[model samples]
Target: MSNSANHIISVSDLKKIYIRGSEHIHAVDGITLDVNQGDYTAFVGPSGSGKTTLLHLLGCLDNPSAGVLTVEGKAVYDKGKFMNERELTKLRRDLFGYVFQKFYLIPTLTVKENILLPFAFYRKAEADKTADRLADLLGLSHRLSHLPKELSGGEMQRVAIARALINKPRILLADEPTGNLDSKRSEEISDIFCKLNREEGLTIILVTHNHALAESAGKMVELKDGKLI
Candidate 1:
C-alpha cells in the first residue's frame, strides 16, 4: 500500500523493457512518481520518449518489467509479479478510463451505443443516466443518435470523452487525446479536461507531445530517452 493516504498512484523505479531480437528496448526506464487523488498530471515528451508507455503501466494496460506500482492502495505490479489479466481487466473497468489519440468510436454504432458499450462487456445495467450526463457535459447530447461517420472531428472526440466517463472511473488515462483535432477543437478539449478536473475532481494522467496542451495540467513531467527529466 502507498504510504500517502491520498496517493491514487504510486510508482517506484518502474521499468518496461522489450526484447527485440538481440536488442533491448527500454520503453519505460526506471521512474518513480506519485499521483494523488484528483490530480491532473501531464506527461510530455517527444515520440518514443516513453510517455505513453508510462501511462499504459499506470493504467494497468501493461505490466512493468520491475519495481512497484500501486493504485488506490493496491499493488498492481511489484517486481516481476503482476496482476493477472482478469484482475487487470477488473481494475481497468472499475477504476480507470482510457482515451486514445484516435477516437476509436465504432463507425456503425450511434454515439449513445458507443458510450454504452462498456456496460455490455461488464454485463452490468446500462448507465443511461450517467451517459446522458456525460454527453451533456461533453456537448454530445445533440449528437447522441448520430453515427461516428456523421459527426465532425470535435464531435467524435467529445463522444469518445463521454464514453470514457460513462463508467465514472477514478482515473482517466488519455494518450494524445487532441492529436487529431484542430487548434480550436484542441482548445475545447483542453477546457473540458480542466473542467472535469476542477468540477468533478477527476484524476487525469495525460500523455502529449504538445507542450501547450500539457501545460493545462496541474503538474507536468517530462521524459527523454525513456527517462524522466
Candidate 2:
C-alpha cells in the first residue's frame, strides 16, 4: 500500500473473472498495488498468471469483476461499479498510452500515418510538431515515410512507441513489448523504455518475461495465479 501524494494509480483487491460456459476463470484475483508518478514498474509471471489481464484493467481496456481502482486520486471503480464509458474512454485517450507485443501497425500506412492515426479521434494543437518530436525522441524521424513492412522489428516497435506517445500520455502500459524481438533488438527497446521513464518522466507499467527488460525498471511486481506474490 502507498500513501504518498504522488501515487498515480492504486488498486485494492482487484479481480477479473471470465465465464466460459459453466467454468469461471479467475484471470486476475485479489491483487493490490500502487504506482507512483513517473515510476517504472514491471509485472512478471508465468503464462497464465494474469499479467496481461491486470495491465488491461489498469489501462481501462478491460473491466474488473471486483475491485477498487483509483487513478490520480479519483475513483474509477469502487464497490462493483465503474466510471461511465465516456469518462473511461477519455482516461484511456488522455491519461494512458498502450503498446502491445504485436506491432499492430497497418502494413500499408507509412510510419507517420500510423503514428498520426489517433488524431482522428481527438484533435491536438500542432499535432505534426508533437509527432515529429516523438519521432525524434524514439529515433523514428528518418523512417517516418516508410511502410511498416520496410522496417526492421526494432524500428517497427519504435514507431509503435512513438504512436503511443503522440498524445503525451502520463502513463504508458506495455504488454510483452519485447516478446517478438531478437536479443539485440530487445536490448534496444529496453534502453528506450529506460530513457522514457528517466528522462521523459513517463510512468511506465509493463508486463514482461524478459529478464533484462524487467531488471531495467525501478520496481518489480511478481504475480502468480492472478495474485501478487
Best model number under lDDT: 2
TM-scores of all predicted structures:
0.94, 0.96
Model 1: runs farther than 4 Å from truth? Answer: 1-3, 120-126
Q: Which candidate number would show the highest TM-score if scored against the true structure?
A: 2
Candidate 2 clashing pairs, residues 3+ apart or interchain: none
Model 2: per-residue Cα lDDT over 1-229, one tens digit each? 6566898999999999999999999999999888999899999999999999999989888888998998888888997988998988888888998999999999999999999878635456578888888889888899989999999999999999988988889999999999999999999999999999999999999999999999999999999999999
Which pairs, if any, clash in model 1? none
Candidate 1 has an lDDT of 0.89
Backbone atom clashes (below 3 Å) for every candidate? 0, 0
lDDT of 1 at 115: 91
Candidate 2 Cα errors over 4 Å, as ranges: 120-125
